[model samples]
Target: MIEVAGDSSRDGDWALVRLRVEGDRILEADADGLGARLGGLSLLEAAAVPGEPLAVDALANALGPIFRARRDSGRVAVAMSGGVDSAVALLRSGPKAIGVTLRLWLDPSGPSAERACCSPEAVLAARRTCHSLGLPHVTLDLRESFRRAVVEPFVRGYGRGETPNPCMRCNGSFRFGQLLDFARRAGADRLATGHYARIVERHGRLLLARAADAGKDQSYMLARLDPRRLRQIEFPLGDQSKERTRAEARAAGLEAAGRADSQEACFLAGDDLRAFLVRRGLAGESGAVVDDEGRELGRHDGFWQFTPGQRRGLGVATGTPLYALRTEPRANRVVVGPREALARRRVRASGRLFAPVERAEVKLRYRSPAVPARVEPASRGFVLHLDQPAYGVAAGQAAVLYEDDAVVGAGIISSSSAT
Candidate 1:
């Protein structure tokens, strides 16, 4: 029997009793933490090793010096987002694991449509797993910082008539920066997360590559992670499939096992971007919708609420199907045109991050397929030569570059100059 003087609920002090059961009969406590009641777990499970208690103490006595030697070594600091990925990430970290989740605002509206990770519920999920695993946990409030780094840029980008990708900014500028700093403070040598991306040393420089599981690869979103930061980052889920990760979480008895994944732009609070914009004071500012020749076709509530290449909720009428061809920020006007108008071949990108490349696979948006492109250095930035024109490729959006499956670099699309 395992006895201790504390409550399991509040983490005062208690002994975790790992019991082996045979149809409700208590057999024994398995130290292997596998099917020995805890031993035969897969290699992916770091806690799957089985050990008898007496054996454990004997082994500890035998290996005490070695254990003590490594005890002072830096451990992994995990970023838990309240999902299976992060839940498993923390559980899989080695002996010195610590968990931390960020408190990000939930947007009132906008694509709660695209689901991925990050939300308030994710924070609690992370904490729960940490408690269950007997690990220390911390949560950092980042609402104001998120607004300045992500939300404000989104508003300004749309206001300037460009499709801004706040997610990329969050990954590159905010998430890694904040969490990595925390890792340093916590005496961790490495920061780990659930992002389905891989880092490998290529040509003496650390570079990002696609996860082995193609369906869950997240390299595009992480293109913004520079070599310096990428050096200190690790993705435990990169080599594992979602099914395997979930199974591992279940095996660990983590509370996040059955928890649902988070939605895109989750900070919006609700699913209405237009409503959120109105609340932000960009509402009620009606502007004109025009064509290239400056001919007014219709009117809009505000130009700051629209994005390029958008084909819905236009509130405009034309003989043919119209698409958001461009936005005239100075005029506060949105220009619509035939669907053909959306096709563009040459895309210009600013704020470029490159490893001296003249070619790469360019992904325009998260879901869009990467296409072969020639990267020509421009006087101010870089120019992308698409093999075939892409529709709705907008500025203020990120264009992640890949050599084969590894991301060599990425840039912010400035605009398209198509005839």
Candidate 2:
């Protein structure tokens, strides 16, 4: 027999559950905490349990090992974010589906902490949705791992004078990695999600493609996912529009049907990047905003606060408007110049390509349009030779290459030039 414990605390109420198990059966169970609802009885009845806030904590912490020995090929594990899209995905996953949610780290002091997708409120909402559908729900408390994998890199990237896209890193590496592992341990053969992107086969290799709804396509954010793992994953909402997802949720009477979409950089918990960085020890230090000629134009708080192509916040007045060209973190300086100076015809990136291609359309930023580019192989990554000058190509941001609507490759922009 092995011992496992789980606990959940909110406001002031709390619950703790301890269980002694052998294989798939619970031999002994005990509960202790500050609440009357604290107990292990629900956990003993099933390998995965659906419950309130406290029960969710107990089961999420203790149920991993108990379900590891069972393998059910028909079971599908759906990733729920306590949103309408995920709820609709769960509804379409059929009866042999299990719901799973990841409880990630978020700033507790943030005003919008409750609105984060992985907040404690979201975890309970996910659990409630599963219970209402008579399906088991599991929560994986991955706050530490998420911080280590996604959050730290974000902070470091900014310190290096780069604008990092945390969502890309989270989706491409951190989030799916943990979810797939949990699915395997929970005896599920496939992990399904509500992502608005599709997986397609090209030359016998799986590649991510844009969703049917162009406005909601997330292929760029997910471009870093290894195609080899695509076989074990499913995107239930890839072909449907966001409207259809909300409609399905409403038809099923799901509480999240009309819920607003979660915001980006969820760990920030709705706080602005500047405030979040300050809290993370990236305090603002006085720096000089200089012109391309090395002449100081204005004063600023920190060089890390600016990125390439930023137009506002320079606090500089001139005959013509000046834009931020680049940041020199070590020098504590921000370089400002004319808008034309921000243009770049060449972008060097460090990453991988799923398919070999000589030419493709490249997306420099999330909302930016894909521009035509010639692909060149590099030592550690690929280079994009833009047919026309692309402005504001920031370092550390993803340069995703696409063939038609499918993402063929992606890399982080290391540097850019006009040549």
Candidate 3:
């Protein structure tokens, strides 16, 4: 049984849906408003809410004042991560800002969960920052939603031998979606965050752009955001570098200005993912570590212990260092080889395109430089032909497309091949 609950209010719609799925079919479905009969409809064909669709002109004329009033007040709901970046953003939002901290679920047994910005201690710190600035603060308890939307899918992806990037899913999809919903209910015009990324309008469409500080640019992590929601978001730190942000924090007398940055995956909370998986009942089964040609080199406790492009922790000694090329969950095998074996010149990905450009620079990993690529339509999504081979490209990682500094499209790397 699966329950899907969504708010269409952002689109001026509402829906409550309950479903029972057995195998790949929806056995039973009960939906109210726009989600009615969702069991048989393709997701894209489903209505945003259950009512006769209203004309854009009619909706605009009816709700224009309400929208204008929100804009007039300059009220923005800022997402505070209890860190220097977000605290500084709250300070810059002026007196009309409200601080919101999302209390998400974390592994209870993880040693440093309290240190994460989503933890209770971090939440208190955010509230203190708001109080100091004479702004109101609210905390939304989203543990259940966060687990279902981000954490569970991450564990499942790893179990299937894929190295999924959960941060992108959380920030671009669930986090922004939740924040927009909260902003609508709070009667605010827009939601703000401290991310080092910019939003801009190009050819009448709002799109994401790289921050002024390119080294700290987070536009790649935010590439999956729905373009329609761009109008209601604000990035105060987009044009500011980390150095200047910290300096401003000191000038404002905020203690968090000197606080260290948070871990890459906040839910990990400084603990290893392997331990968390074990506690979640994904105990590793002994497996064989083999070369790409099926020559057994040594043994591993679990195939899930390895990720594509990983260069360390392989117990096998083959004279030369071996990098993990890929994991085969079905065969219970980990494939290791020379670093050159990981290079690939072509990639296939599945996801929607934010723009219709046929050619752009594609980035396979966050830290990897964007390489010139020829993009083309594919069966389910799109294909990328890189100008040069990239090393360590992995499935389940985002392939974000860019034209100059603007993000035009994004998708998951479903598979890759060496030229």
Candidate 4:
């Protein structure tokens, strides 16, 4: 049975909630009718502690001092990644910042095991840093939501022989969207992140711009943020160099100042995904790994072992180099082809998250240079006409759009077989 446990003061001063995430877990409820009344709350808080009384006023006061202090800069909800970037963001934003870190689930099985933004250790580190800086820290338990929104899609995408980019989805939609909801509920004004991207008003329209540090600029990964949300967000490291950011963090004496950078997709913690997948009970019954035209090249333990455009470790030693081009889930086979087969000049992206405007830059992958493209609106999606064909455009990956360097919007790459 589902239940909720919470404590509230006489005036509803503070509310502490304990939630049960799974069906097997029991959350005790106050049956005395004296339980705190959870009335109307914004959708964001509702996702966290549902059915709780509205503490809107309290949330407001809690956010008031910071907003007032900013006077010019405005209040911001900073996503703390338990690393130097976000740590410095929190310090720099000062009173206007509420540090938040999500505790995303780490699947025992998944490729590229690395410590992600969500881990017990990472959460604790973020909390300590926030407390040390005299700022309140909140841990948003988004494990279930994350699984549905990211992990599940990743697995399914891979199964379909596509490459997925969960970071774009999490950053552009789930994470920031939730933060904005938090701001509205708490009466805060804006949100911020340690991303090396910039936000500026160009020609009266807010734009997501590139950061000064090319090496650290994450505009590509964040190309999915809606243009409408730009006014309510901040990217402080945009104009600053990575070295200067470190210097600033050092000058502020933050613990995360010297902390090593967390690699992409922290949930994996460096574990091998194939093993994890097997542990998760998706062990393979051996499938055929084939070359173009249904020619059997070798065999794979499972279809999950391959992704679109993957070129290494094919097990089969063909005289000519080969790369994964597709996964035929129906046949439980992975399709391989020559390296030249990866190129594409046109991309059709559907279920797009934002509307397109004129010519923009399209990024095929993170850290990949932005390619000039004319993004044309296609129903609920978009069609990217690239200046030059881009190779390795995986269907599950995101086709993020940019104009003048800011992330305007993004969508899943539905097809990139454009010649």
Return the top candidate by TM-score: 2
lDDT of 4 by residue, 42-126 (tens): 2222222312233322222222222212223355677888888889888878675667777678864454323456765676577
**Order of all candidates by TM-score, from best down to worst?**
2, 3, 1, 4
Q: Write the per-residue lDDT of candidate 2 for residues 1-419, one digit (tens) a residue.
A: 68888776767887777777776666676754323332333332353444455755665677743555367788888998888888888998888788888989886556667678898788778877887887877777888889999999999999999999999899888999988898887788999998899999885788899999999988888889888889999999999899999988989999989778876677876688898888887969998999988999899998898988898899899999899999998899999999999999999999998898999999999999999999999999998899999999899999999999888999889999999
- Cα lDDT tens digits for candidate 1, 116-148: 345545655665677567665555667778888
Per-residue lDDT over 1-419 for candidate 3, one digit per residue giving the tens place of the 0 to 100 score = 44333222325554344444433234455544332454654221221112322221122112211121123257788898889999998888887777777878888888856568787667667766776676656667788889999999998888888888998899878999888886775557888898999998775789999999998899999998988898898889999899999999999999789888876788898788899888876768988999989999988987887877898888898778899999999999999999999989999998767887888999999998889999987877789999999989988899999988889888889999997
Q: What is the lDDT of residue 233 in candidate 3?
A: 89
Q: Where does candidate 4 stray beyond 4 Å?
A: 1-75, 108-115, 351-356
Best by lDDT: 2
Better of 1 and 4 by lDDT: 1
The 10 consecutive residues of candidate 3 with the worst lDDT sum are 60-69
- Cα RMSD of all models vs. native, in order, equals 10.7, 2.5, 13.0, 8.7
Better of 3 and 4 by TM-score: 3
Which whole-number lDDT from 0 to 100 does residue 291 have in model 2? Answer: 92
Task: Give the TM-scores of the predictions, in the order they appear.
Answer: 0.78, 0.94, 0.82, 0.78
